[model samples]
Target: MHMTVCLVLAWILIYLCVMKGIKSSGKVMYITATFPYVVTTAFLVRSSTLEGAMDGLYYMISPDLNRLFDPEVWLDAATQIFFSMGLGFGGLIAFGSYNELKNNCVKDTVYLSIANLLTSLYTAIVVFCVIGFMGHQTYMDCLDNDYKTLMTLYPHKYGSLEELKTSIKLDEYIFWMEHQFHHSEFPLLSNASRYCNYKDIIASSAQGTGLAFVVFTEAILQFPFPPLWAVLFFLMLLMLGLGSMFGTLEGVITSLNDSHVITVKKPVLTAVLCGTACVIGLLFTTRAGQYWVSLFDHFAGSYALMCIAFFEIIAVIYVYGYRRFLNDLEFMTTERPGKYWTITWRFVSPVIMLILFFSSIIKSFSHHPVYSAYDPITTAQVDTAYPAWALFVALMLVSLALAPTPFIYFVRKFKIWKIEGDIPAASKCLGSTPSTTYMLKSEPSFNRMVESTASELQTIGMNGPSTNGSARNSENDRKGNGSNRHPPKRN
Candidate 1:
């Protein structure tokens, strides 16, 4: 019941913020976007007072150079980078589309990129400090209780309890004791150990939900006014979640509104979208919600994002033509892109993404897919191979995202599923868009481009060829220093 209420309240807040479109969401961003930084800053200061905070920071900086060779490590790093920067998501593009044509996109990109990188690094340092504290606290608690417990269970190992205390300095005796009580000796120890060594905590680092719920919650209890810190931390999380949600929902709403797919008011569309999503979200509020979430994220999140992102880079850099893109940027900024942009677009980004995407897939097939399964009785997680049904579900989830490209290709090419081009509702469909304009005005290139889009270009560009289809004019270019000769206008 509590979960249900929380779920509803969250959706209600989302609806209220986005109901009026960017006007409402923009105002809310003042709080939602900035509150996380405040909480993170506070935590950074407070973490310094913790018993093992320095240990955690050191754990973070210390590198595992060997892991660089592991495909899984690269895949994991790519996943974090993708989600952190909101790559493969159309949210940032949707928000940027609102800016005027002459907006300083290059400057915005550089500043935001640097800010995001620094923020992610800072947050990692802070989180590791808390995790270090958690590890140290656990070790201390174990030390406090192990003496009495060890005396009761293994009195035969020593002459007396006092003897056992003095012999703790003896490596053999301590190792034997850890075997009886903890079984957490260096060679034997894994993340499943009840007590952790702070130095070894990197292997057991809690992340995502575990970091937020278990590590942070326990660490907060060690602070002076746990309740106050708890409130602030959770409130920060709420805002962080809402900040991301706003962009995702805004992207969906704006695309639908711009596409002119269905005739509906913005407020009504926003309500319907949020309401439907909230109802679907209830599945995630159940006792098995975490498992369901894990499944969804495993299948639909990483690989799908990689696939979409790979294709997006291909579309923009290769199919759309690189020189054309660079030309557009040059026209808008009045300065040509440097070698850095060229290297990233032409080679680096795509190669890295493609390698990561395919390497992950190869690794999955090579080894059975295993997820860390929670053991309720012991309150520990065990790495368990996905069951048959779970594997099927994972396959289906991936298919839902990826099978469409080929399906649409077959349907469109074979004309098996004919789209009535004359239909009124289809007037503003993407395939039939008249919103685009040409850049390369060579007769062959322009005609080829027009022919590719076909009849749709006829609606608006019918008279375009008659006059001067070779070039188009400067509506805002002069005011903005030739802001691009042919910027595609979207409603």
Candidate 2:
């Protein structure tokens, strides 16, 4: 029920922004894009100051330099970069389209990169800090623990069984439980003891997997100003998620819209697409809701972004012509784009993308564990099954692959997709528009007819100087003579 509401509300907000067009959606994007940074940063600062936080920070930053040589680490980093920056997938291009033609794409690109990097760093800190407090040795181990033990320990342990059963202050019970975990060395001790006490370990394990729903709800309920804080937190998350989603929807829609096959009526088209999304979302409300989401997320959110980023790099630096790209940078920063960006986009981006693509492909094909938990539908299996979720992801990838077919055909047929003939190109659509001449000449027949009609009007009502005769026109009047001025001449 909770996830359902969140999903519904999220789609509702995204659809509303689409109704406003890409330009208006910029406000939404800006807010959403910048928000997670603030939250994560705040949490990071708090986390970093906690005991043992430095150890976690060190663990994150001091990556095995050998991991760099392994190619997989580089791939992971690149994938993270692409996803965080909203690169590749039509999101960036669509957002860029919404920008002023004169707006600096190079600067925007750099700024976006820096912002994403900073956010990731902050997130890492927050993640590590929490893990450090939990005394987990590695990220994978922490993930295995499912981030629940800390949040739920207090609620389950601090309150007596009677207190838990009889308390009207459910929030207090949760708080009490969390406090126990916060102050206790149970998590660390569990790691040290290898969870020898099997019963307690199993209980802790159960809490970890269910934390997203259970403990998170408990934390929210226990807020000092529950109503206000809950409103703020949910609204903030909604804005952030919607902003990201708006970008994704806009990218896909623009890719189709620019082809001219979808028609140019943006308002109606946007509403329809968003409505369709809501209907699709309804599929996740059933018994396999989580499965559905995970499927879409795995494919569309991860690998798709990598592919998109690869193509984006190719388009920007190679196909667009690097010197021309340099000029875009010069216009924005008042200095030429550095050599580093050129190299990054050209050589580095593609290589990184390839590595990530191959790594995922290899992983999928390998006999490695699929790492999933038991659900109502299926027990925990060694290999992830081709469940509904997998099918969902497959559909998304297939759609992405096939999406350009009609678009390519349309552009070839109508020539509406050219940057000069079409509009400004960018990763994110940014209030982009057709060229001014295109706008003026769009109604070419009407313009031509108007000009012809004006000319014909000029030829009428000029027959004579005294009235409306052709003989006494401006030429005759200018010469101080009128061919039909004399009445004798009329006879």
Candidate 3:
């Protein structure tokens, strides 16, 4: 019931913020977007003072060139890029569609891309710094525990300063201390020492919600004034989450509006959508919610994203025709895309995306879906393998998300084939004609408009302003009379 209330409140907040479209949401972003950066910067600055903070920073930025050779690493990098840029999600596209027809999207794209990359790097720095402090604290705690044990066991061994120096070989003592603690018995201490040496807390980090709610919260608690920083950190996370939700929700609302499938007032439509989503979201608040969330995240969140992206690229580049796409861009931007953009859209991106998609599928099948289940009383890790039926359900969820891509593709193909079947055999035998010919054939009215405009210009040039008035009047009459007619062919 508590979770239900929270979910309802969240949806209410989202609906209130975005019901008026960008007008309300854009104003909300002033705080939601900027406040996180301020909080993150504060965390980063505070973390720098902690011991071993540089180690964390070094681990983050120092590249292992050999890791680049691993396909999994490349896949991970691509996934990060896709998520950070919100690519393939339809959210960015929906947001951009709200802009004016001639908005400078090229500039906006470049700026936003760079900003996204920088923000990701900055957040990594802040996260790693906290991790570094956590590592330092963990090591100290382990050492303290070991010292207490030794004092309890052999108090007389350290009774005199001279005896203490003579009896303890520092290297031997250090070795014994590390070897004595069983990781299961002292999980935090054991892991802390390992993380300190390797400087790679990220490797042990949790995925999805665990990283945000568990790992980050754990790190925040290590700071001075834990309550204050914890509040600030979570508040920042909340704002960022709300901001993202706004975009995604707005995308759905805008899509429905554009489709004309919901013929209600905007606010009424928004309320219906948000209310439905809230009710559906109640499933995630159940006792088994975590497992369901894991399933959804694995199948819908990861696999469906790549599949959607692959189809989107194929549709734009192949179905839409590359040259026609470029012409559309030129119309909006007044500048044609350069060679690099052309090559990427046509070849490079599609190939890379296909590889990633296949690789993900292969990886998914190779391992059964397993999530960590902890004992509530003792907090010991228990491996929980998803049941076979759950796996099937996950696959179904992925299929559902991916259903539209091929369904739409085949429907479009069938329509094209049906149209071509009506064309004469002779024209069919001539093979695929240029898209320009097809365009002209499809829009006879456009051809007439062009011809009429050309004829008007020619008359003005040939006769000058003395005869311009009469020529213009006649042309206007012709346009008014048969604006929809194809102009008669000139020999």
Candidate 4:
């Protein structure tokens, strides 16, 4: 019930931000996006005073080179990079379309990428410091309280650390301290020592989820103005989450509108999308919601992301043609891509993405997908595979996400869902014709969309919307009557 209310509130917030298109959401971002920095700085300052916070700073720790060969590490890194840079989600493209035709997107992208990297590093450091403090507290708690009880249960000959240190190896000491015997009575096992193992403590501490609650809950209990920073912290998370949703929902909304299958006002469409999503999302608020989230994430989050990214790259570079893309980029930015771009886009990116996509597919089939599960009795997190029916549902999600790529390809290839003036299957599928492509056409600038000249449009294209009275003259040209001289600007 709590989750349901929260989900509804979130959807309502999303609707308010996005309902009027970017106008309302753009204003809301001022609070959502910037407040996190303020909260984080506060955390950083408070965290430094923590008794053993530095113990959590993985940055100060030496690198473990042995993990480089790990496949899981590579896959995880790929997923992080994709999501971090907003590569596969279509958000970047959707948002970028709003930019002016002459916008220096190259510079903007580079700056944003650097900012994103730094932001991720900063956020991780904050999380690490907090986790480190938690571990230190955990260790101290076990020492202060649990040690006395364990000693009473099983008397150790060496009542103190100095004597116990000589009797047992550190490995055995760790086993006894962590209660590796699963809370059972063992004759050789003794009480905990005063010496705290910071290494083991930090290593065993969980990061990410539920961490913020623990951190802020403590702040609310211990700090002055208890709820201030706690509220800010939660709001930071809220904005960060909604910020991503803003772009994703916009992409979905825009695509549906552009599909020519659905016709509705932006407000109506936004409400419908938000309402439908809220209904679907209610499943996530259920008791089985965690399992459903895991299932969707396993299939859609990883596998389907790679599939979408791989095809998008292929369609643009391979189907669209390298030279044509360069030409399009030049037309938009008035700058041609360099040799480095050519090499990476045509060869390096495709090869790497292909390998990763196929490998994920193979791994998914070879072994069952597992999710993180907690054992209440053992007080430990464990990996558990999905049940057979759950696995089937997961696969269906993957298939549903992926089926459209090939389905649309064949549809367009055979003219099943023919548009009035789409390029032929040979031209589209095989990239046989360059002149018919949008490569030579200029992407319409909202400001100058009213007044496009023959000089502005390098070629006559039939696919874009009708731009009859479009001119280079003035804003009033936006209302100009149809003049067959200029073909429609690409939508």
lDDT of each: 0.70, 0.52, 0.66, 0.65
Give a tens-digit lDDT track for model 4, residues 1-491.
99999999999989988886555676787887788888888888887677667877863364678977555556667887877777788777756654544466788988998998999888777777776777767776755454444455555555865444455554665575565552354443333434456677667655345455665466345445767767877778898888888888877865564443555666788899999999989999888787787677667787778889888989988886888777656654568899999999999988887887777667666887788788888888788887898877887888888897899889867869754322221121112123334442332231133244334433223343222312122222212221122235545
- Tell me the spans in candidate 2 whose CA falls farther than 4 Å from its real position: 1-6, 29-76, 133-232, 253-259, 316-320, 323-339, 368-371, 375-399, 402-491
Give the winner by lDDT.
1
Model 1 global lDDT (CA atoms, 0 to 1): 0.70
State the local distance difference test value for candidate 3. Answer: 0.66
Task: For candidate 1, write residues 1-491 as lDDT tens digits.
Answer: 89999999999999999887666788899999889999999999999788878887788788989989888788877877778777777787768765544456799888988998999998988898888788777666655455655666666777776887786754554455445544633233333234424355545767668889988998888899999999999999999899988998877776665544444777788889999989988988998888878888876888887887887788788876788677656644567799999999989999998888788889887988988888888777888898899889888888777786678668756868653321222222211112223432333434544555555456435332322221223222222111122223322
Put down candidate 2 lDDT per residue, 231-261, tens digits, no spaces. 6555656666677687778777766665334
Pairs with steric clashes in candidate 1? none
**How far in Å is the alpha carbon of 421 misplaced in model 3?**
26
- Flag clash pairs in model 4: 450-470, 450-471, 451-470, 451-471, 451-472, 452-470, 452-471, 468-483
TM-scores of all predicted structures: 0.78, 0.60, 0.76, 0.79
CA lDDT, candidate 4, residue 457:
34
Q: How many steric overlaps does candidate 4 have?
A: 8
Worst 10 residues of 2 by lDDT: 482-491
